[model samples]
Target: MKQRGFSRRSFLQLTAGALGASLLAACGSSEASQPTQTGSGGGGAQPTTASGSPAPAVITGVTLRVVGTGVTLLEPIREQAEKDLGIKLEYDVNDGPAAQQKAATQPQSWDLYDQWFNSVKIVWGSGNAAPIDINRIQEWDKISPMPKEGKLTPEAKEGDGDAPYRILYVQPDNTLGSIPTEQISMLPLTFNVDSFGYRSDLVDEEDVDSWAILFNPKYKGKIGLYSDPSTGLMDLALGAQAAGLATFQNIGNMTREEIDTIMEILIEQKRAGQFRAFWNSFDESVNLMASGEVVVESMWSPAVTALQVRDVPVVYASPKEGYRGWYGGMMLNKNASDKVLDACYEYLNWWLNGWAGAVVARQGYYFCIPENVKRHLSQADWDYWYDGKPAAEDLLDPFGSVVAKAGSVRDGGDLVTRVSNIAVWNSVMDEHQYLVTKWNEFLAS
Candidate 1:
């Protein structure tokens, strides 16, 4: 069940992605309207200062409003950005669903959105979002081509052109949204992977090598599932692929029939009362595992770290099937002034090249600019995080025990394989609605 008192924070910190979504919606005020800036001819448009200077004092003495889902680790980074850029950053945090609802109803209230692929598609399809000007970004060329070149609908290929959104940030894998240019609509934020979290006190390590631990009847009423459909469904698909019922490529290109088959298996498991709880928030999932209410569940890297920090007797498994993952980036809002926009770029560049990536890595999550930050991290740091060994100190709690161990992708141990395959999962999701429906029915049953 969805946890009470778990407020959704903005997903993107530096970008004004998820602000004011809930307040106006609850108040029923339509005061905000989506803002669109006219694109300049040669370079991106520049906003004039009151003094008529070209740049507006380097974003000093200015406040930029950003919105998104919140992460505890990012609070310090937000403060650092404010100090470095000479700008004050105000944030509004909401979850993916709430953010999408607000963006749909009051587009102008939020400057940008840091959400999953489904939410991004909804905003783009509804004409609520503005297209980005990719030309002004300095490192635009560093972005991978999948997100930029992949949006070609046949009609879009004609005069319609690609969708107006520019990717300012991107996860290494383009599962959730496109990679953004320095001036793109979105920017890459952090790199994260998904794994099966289990109670070391209950399940033996050898017996839980595969995804089967989730469906094991012996653990009925002790399993947890994420409330979000996308992650759960992806887990099901990955589990099915691991069990030899399907291949990752097959799951990616799943037909309705294939989805139905997978869904049927999940429904059967659900009917058997396998799930202990369905978690809707990060805290809920972490708490459930920490308190021993759940023995196993699909989980992200950071949350597992959080639990370990609390001295929870849990371990993140490298299942035989492989881990699931996603990447995120920073995006610019069309409504942001040019000065604020430049400050956003400065923050993005510094984040990718500076200590920000290292800070993120310490929390057991990867940063998008892995290459640039390699020298900043130590060999032991690389082994524990990227190489998949457990680090001794818990960056999240500082008192938690080391939890993760290194493994291979084929043996369910690789992180890169998880993030790089999000697009494939998107395609698989399209064909797997029947399966999703079945899974939902199973949950209800």
Candidate 2:
């Protein structure tokens, strides 16, 4: 799901309006329709420069235009890219859906798209994305075969042939997209898995182990849920799996009747007043948890980490059913000038080699690189991180107080059930609208 505040309906409506405008704009046929160049000159692929050469083959004196959400995690990488690549990196911040709309209208203006997996589909469907030359990117070979196929295949219908969507970027070994670029199209950045975040001060351990805890009568009106239908529906599907109502293997092939059955259980849960608030952003989620407005809620790793940073007395728990997760990669804009493109490649290589990975690990998310970075870290860092060793002194927040433990999945008690199968999620997204409507009706009734 696109991590933005707009409702799904609102986003669709906006896209429809934008499409109409784009069609009208096309009729005018102005120079604006063409891509505007924004970087240093350099065209044909050149031979690799040797180390210590006066001028490395590196693209210089260029500005790479990147457009995406202004999430906090990207800042450090952005700064590093500018320094290491010797090029200016420009960012255009847009919420996920908005990014798609902008890209569709001004496809040539931007060079790279940093977005969620689902938003990537919308961007490609709108014909805003450029075809990636797989042969040019050396790291493409590292990607697993399944996601490679997913990027190549378009979104297929119930019985139609495979979809033919072109993958521009992909996270390595991550199923979120196809085509791995060391930096753009697909370079593994971080692995962020989702699990239930609950108030340890309220819910007991035993009661919170299963998906049923979200619907338990005692916690009615004290739970939180994401406003996005995709997340809520996925959680319900996971719960259905736990209830023996469904399984991941069957989830993809489920008939309408099966989907309706899963929807019914979620509807019933909604009718019971389970959700206290439907959070649409990280700030809102943090406020909800910190204020004690919610006892338990579906949460991503970052949010849990944020809460612990504030000493909210919360714990991220992996229920018996498992956790839902996603991994993201950077994609180069097809419109980027050769200079900017080369700079992007340099940044991408640097990120993968361990610097960016270490920073992400500090934020409680896993980086996609191999495990050797641990050797460079101090004992305290390793213990507090990989080993899940609780801090003897309470972790302090900006305001100065004790912090909560947001346990790692690698730790024994926090085992996460993997949920990265794209085929399964695609099927789930197909049924998302119906699920959301049913859930809304349940909330109303």
Candidate 3:
């Protein structure tokens, strides 16, 4: 029997890659885009379940425009939501910088914004992060208190995932407060702790765990790096520090001096042909690895999984310096109408209905509500991805396609085990413009 709010058939049919994806289609796997994966619910009649039950309902005339990147995990679920709830999940996907610009200048372009937490600060600067009342979100109580309270462990602050105090709980006047309140900044979606990945078949496992391997002169010109300043900068910072070229007081919020030092090392590497290519999206990262042009690169988990599934032998490294983490989530547009606001709340609640979380787990992400998501997955599925157990059988993605072979074990172990060890979250520091400028120069150099 299917759950009432989400039918088994109406649930998402797509899977994910590790880390985040751009808001465009770029598949790293050999079968990145199969004809069978084409039932995306962009424009279709409300679908029916095997039992002939009516799909769930939303306000007939209303369509919630969701803005996000082109991540595949959301495809099946987005299709299912439009079919089951009978509302259009219109998307306006964009790359990292373009998406941030959209929030700053085009708040009304979309009713909901789905992006990373780091991007929220930029959106909030433009007054686009509408305060979402906790009362309206059905999952408010069920959300792990860690988000509101702001610390998963004594060392790791809420910044690693949800730092509610930073933006949550706005007053009627829209001024922010530090305490947890009835209103939240955004709905914490999915996140993961990540590090660079390499071709284990090429790089010895003993040389893979440390970040220094990225800057090793031996592999220079055969490495890939992220083009995005935030993620890519952290990777370089870790490499620079690990190689003893430079050390920072706080790499997350690097000072101008620290930035220059980091850039100098990275620029030196770039000029020396240390990097094969710079990737701006997850697909590019996967393609670079699959092409065998670059033997090592910073990567997303899904990319690693994608390569391994193809027998490419990629490994997502758990660096000795610690993981660079990120959280992707949803925020209401500040200028939406009451009707749109209500519809948006329904949509947020719908995510917590468990189906979306299950789809996310397949690609190596940890959902805000894992228990709710666990209900939709098999014991074997959960055991392999979440519990770090060996796959009892071939593990399938949300599309019911084999992603992991039998006897394969997850790389970093369980969700709790991975997230609790995060060293920093993706962030836009005080000197973002300077950092971006340096990043661009490094790429062009």
Of the candidates shown, which would achieve the greatest lDDT relative to the real structure? 3
Error of 3 at 383 (Å): 1.2
- Write the candidate numbers in order of decreasing TM-score: 3, 2, 1
Compute the lDDT of residue 121 as modeled in candidate 1.
Answer: 37
* After superposition, candidate 3 runs with Cα above 4 Å error: 1-58, 153-165, 168-178
Badly placed stretches (over 4 Å) of model 2 are 1-58, 71-73, 103-105, 131-185, 244-259, 371-379, 387-428, 431-445
Model 3 steric clash pairs: 12-76, 12-77, 17-302, 18-302, 22-70, 23-69, 23-70, 221-274
Per-residue lDDT of model 1, residues 61-167, tens digit only: 76666566664226665676665545676666766556656565565675655544334433443445544445543344444333344322322211111112222
lDDT of 2 by residue, 19-74 (tens): 44323323322200111112232454433211111122446677777776654226
User: How much is the lDDT of residue 200 in candidate 2?
Assistant: 86
lDDT of each: 0.51, 0.52, 0.68
Q: In model 1, how large is the Cα lDDT of residue 95? A: 65
**Model 3: per-residue Cα lDDT over 1-445, one tens digit each:** 1111211122112101111222211222120010110111233344433212223334555788877775522677788766655577787777655565666567778888887777655665566667777776645667665455545555653333223345445544454445556776678877777788888778877778778888898887888988777778888888878888888877777898988989888888888888888786778888899988999898888888888888887878877677887777788898877667766776776676667777878877777767767776789988988888999998887677788889988888876667666666787665766676676677668
Residue 174 in model 3: lDDT: 53
